[model samples]
Target: MAIQFIKKITFNHPQSLLSFRLKTTSSQYVASRFRDATFEKFMDHYKNLLKVISIQDLILANPKNNPPSVSVDFINRLSQKLHLNRGATAFLRKYPRIFEIYYDPTLSKPYCKLTPTAMQISIEEAAAIQNTHPLVIDRLTRLLSMSKSKTLPLRAIFKVWRELGLPDDFEDSVLAQNPHLFHILDAHEPNTHLIKLVGTTPGHENFTAAVENWRIMECCKDECSVDRTEMRYSFRHGFPPCMKLKKNLRAKVKEWQKLPYTGPYEEFTNMKKRSKTAVMEIEKRAVAIVHEFLSLTVEKTVEVEKISHFRTWFGIDLNVRDLFLDHPGMFYLSTKGKRHTVFLREAYERGCLVDPNPVYVVRRKLLDLVILGRRGLRSGDHKLSSSESEEDDDLLEMENDQGDIL
Candidate 1:
């Protein structure tokens, strides 16, 4: 899909890069326009990582089996749904350190199970989730508080639970423990559930955005003379090396960054004027809200469509894509797979999270396992044929190339 998108663009010169000229609802042309290959590669890697993790979760979901093994036939039947490009047997065989295929004599068929290392990593992930329960609750509460009604659909929350680092049994494990802060009530729609914030929790009433904290810390670290008010209204910008901002565009962005606007956690619905200045401030507030949302995620990123699911609830009326494109320095849009993913530019350095969370650390371990493939297996445990060894080397080389950009 990414390849096809690239092919459709016509570059005028050899140095020309992928660019878009999107018009926002206010009929203003977006000044920033360029793609960042680093982020695109980052999203491409996660695309496969997410698929591997999903398959892992599916196998782990069935705890009835003593060792949690599933039949190879079952996975084969659901390969398409699992989004596996290759056959199930081949895919499982590729990541030998994470999965093991063995013959089940009683069933007269082969079954798949997590290898010891993978199982250990899963255990660690569970522990990390438990240890970070309070942080998870805080993130969830902030998410709910951003909405107009201080509520979000249960189904929508389920869609982003993984990104937000919520546990599998969040309803019972997280929400049930925080009755004072949250409540699950049936929505007006039949069979729908809504998770609503009861009121402002005592300590959380003055919740500060992650981005805001970072800005202040950066200012303090540099000992800059910039006023606190100006810092409050400003955001850091980091454009890709390939993008060259025009002189006029740079000046405009500098002015825009200094514009005073409502913070993400503050109220903005009171301003309903249709003047150009009012519209711009509202748009800036929308950007701040999205920025804060991404800041709360474990990886500082989310699928654009997944975030769009909460648009109405968050009172963001502009096109999400346009907003991301308009501020290339603050956010990056990656159309690497079928979905578009937006990354918080400041949260990541190169291809890694700047301040890794406990959950992200464990998840990275799983990703490493996938990237290492059979190389991670014990030398004497499994022997690869010449052709298989060559294949593994090729896979490693490809991953290494992507790693360089990440």
Candidate 2:
């Protein structure tokens, strides 16, 4: 693949060599990852990664404050470029362990060893931290009694439950009442294609089956620490690290719980770690913000319209394929009323579009003529360049405050 070592010193400047400020990111990375993988392999690897790396996650992790200001769309395009989304989630869901595995906080920290022994975490705090339902305390206590052994095979305990004719639906009811617990029990489900229910539990076989291949584990420790150590277990699962947006969403959504979820912190943490779709969460919010900020609406949807050609407000039309070869910038849309004036410029050539222009136009809303380029921003405080000549000069790269494309 053709590549260039983009220097990282351009964030505070606009004219750096690798800094061409545009609305899109390059699609080359996507093309490369997809080149040789079989349909199945590509679907599993690339699609999962895309679901794992959301737009919001990308923006949050690689904020403009950081050096590698990669574009979220570019990342998605890369995943799609590899032709991985073809099979959708079913194929990838089977290989839940493709990403890293983490532990459940109700157990021990993820790296700790898993012990078959189950200890009862106090019901009081469990309601708060675990998102546990208030009605299930008795069931929990009973389960804890069955799990007291330091190394009881989970299968054995469930077998005993089954022998006792304790219905699996009873467990499901408890889980349904407490989704938090379900997240915990199901967290390890994502690590393998299909988890086999084993050990010495009776009424627990079907109970265990319900949680197979779910992805729910925590990444941090403080959230998992209990006042008592026995309250936890060593957690483990095969789930990718939570993307940025997932964390943000967890932070936002978990706060609104009606009753405290009585699941392990690892469970909440694992919910924080979902498929690649997490990354787009923030950008999706930002887009919403921009729409509200600008009072913009999708005035109309043009169906069956051919994108055979488009150009800038200047009325120049170019085929989509030759957009870059002719314009050397990027493709952009300016919406006024029901019509979206299509155009190509530096952005179309180099690469993409989002609501806020680019992070450089960091305000939640963008108005007036905004030109995104690879130009490095000057100081954290910036004044929009009033230089009309600069606006017209697409070929010229932006310079840092030092006035060099360094």
Candidate 3:
């Protein structure tokens, strides 16, 4: 389902209305030591692993199935239906511990069965979902609060569920159950929906505080500045420890950072808006909102463009790639996986998130199970080795060539 945004919601004031435009710039695909390689590796390793889990879940949920073991042919067909380029046979062989491969000698065919370990993991994941229900709601609250219209199209929300660490069908299961917190609106497009926060303002106290804190830090750095060129570099202290800066690159970044900007949360609706100034502020606030959003995530990072879906709502009418390039100290853009993702520099240290969540721990454990299965297969420790047909060569294709996936 696609979200057909009929019109971007704009502030009534003409002063606030600016044509959304972004200046195109060449991107330097850079890597940082604090890029949370483990998380990235897990996601890459499980890209198809999770697909298998989703398939298993779908099969198990079928009321007609008694044992819930789906045939290999059924999984192959389901893979096509789900657009899973990675064939089910390869996936089962890749993660034998999760998917019990039962072959009937007479028929010479394989049946995909969920292993006990996988079953246990499902139970643990369910428990984690139950435990983190409140946090998930709070996460939803913050997401809605950050939007300019204080609402998000349901289709957009669905796309970023994995990044948000939300369970499948959360809109129906979790969101639908909470009528007092969220209101689902029927849009002109059938099955397309909009989600609005109930009785809540768009402004979030935490985001406001973060903006103030950043300002205070900037001011303190300004006091010790040597010159205009050096003044911009003064804020380099805010950069994460892993950010190794080259002198020439540092100068270039400082010059870009010196551009005048306004806060994302500030009342720009009444201000005399210079197009360049408004754009800079909008981009800055986009950064701030993203920073705050990531802070609330179990992992303090998200797909770069996933946050861009709120561009209209956030009043960000500029290229987000420019923002990441200009503000390397604040955010780290990683091209590790299929998508280029943005990570909060300060929130991560030594390839791991500095602030870890319990739910993340549970998820990590589940990931470990998948990794162990792969290890077992690699080591030939498992007797379930089956030569499966290979496919999904582009399963790891880059999601976008530029920053416009938003």
Best by TM-score: 1
> After best superposition, candidate 2 residue 5: deviation in angstroms?
38
Best by lDDT: 1
Q: Per-residue lDDT tens digits of candidate 1, residues 62-161?
A: 8998799888899889888877778798888878878888999998999899989899999998899899988899899999988888999999999899
Instruction: Write model 2 residue lDDT over 47-105, tens digit each, in one string.
Output: 33334323223333543432223332344455554343443233222222221123444
lDDT at 169, model 2: 46
Measured on C-alpha atoms, candidate 1 has an lDDT of 0.82
Q: Rank by lDDT, highest first.
A: 1, 3, 2
Report the Cα lDDT for candidate 3: 0.63
Q: How many backbone collisions does model 3 have? A: 1
lDDT of 3 by residue, 152-186 (tens): 88888886776676777697877888887789998
Q: What are the runs in model 2 whose C-alpha is more than 4 Å off?
A: 1-183, 186-381, 397-406
Q: How well does model 2 score by local distance difference test?
A: 0.26
